[model samples]
Target: MAKVQVLGTGCAKCGYLLKNAQVAANERQAGDVVEKLDDMLQVHEFNPSALPALAIDGKVVTVGTLPSPSEIRQLIEQSQEVEE
Candidate 1:
């Protein structure tokens, strides 16, 4: 399963991204797990250069911008490809 991690401080952008991730996962129906990292310490540990960054299975995919659900689904597919 792909692990989608949204790193942010629970701001609007962050929340939007989190929702998008969930939407993407649901649409894909691939058992992807979407999670949010709001704690500064946890998010800082991820070491994202920008807020609202996205990571798939622990690999950073995008930062500072929200991608569409389709795009996010594609990302999850790519991550699963790597795993396989």
Candidate 2:
């Protein structure tokens, strides 16, 4: 499993990112790997730089702008590769 995390407040973009991350993980057959960290303070604890960030296995991958589903899928695949 990839253990993907979507960090952000309960905003539209955040929700979309969470949904897309889940879809990407599903496409890659990573099981239920996507999680959302909607609490701002908790998000800061992970990466105080920006909201709407993406993380895999507790490591921040991307921040700010939303990534496409294809991109998210690629990211998941890459994380799995790193773990192996």
Query: Best candidate, lDDT-wise?
Result: 1
What lDDT does each candidate get? 0.92, 0.85
Residue-by-residue lDDT tens digits, candidate 1, 1-84: 789999998899999999999999999887889999998998887788998999998888999999989999998998888888
Q: What is the lDDT of residue 5 in candidate 1?
A: 96
What is the Cα-based lDDT of residue 53 in candidate 2?
93
Residue 7, candidate 1: Cα error in Å is 0.5
lDDT of 2 at 78: 87
- Give the runs in model 2 whose Cα sits over 4 Å from its true position: none
Candidate 2 yields a Cα-based lDDT of 0.85
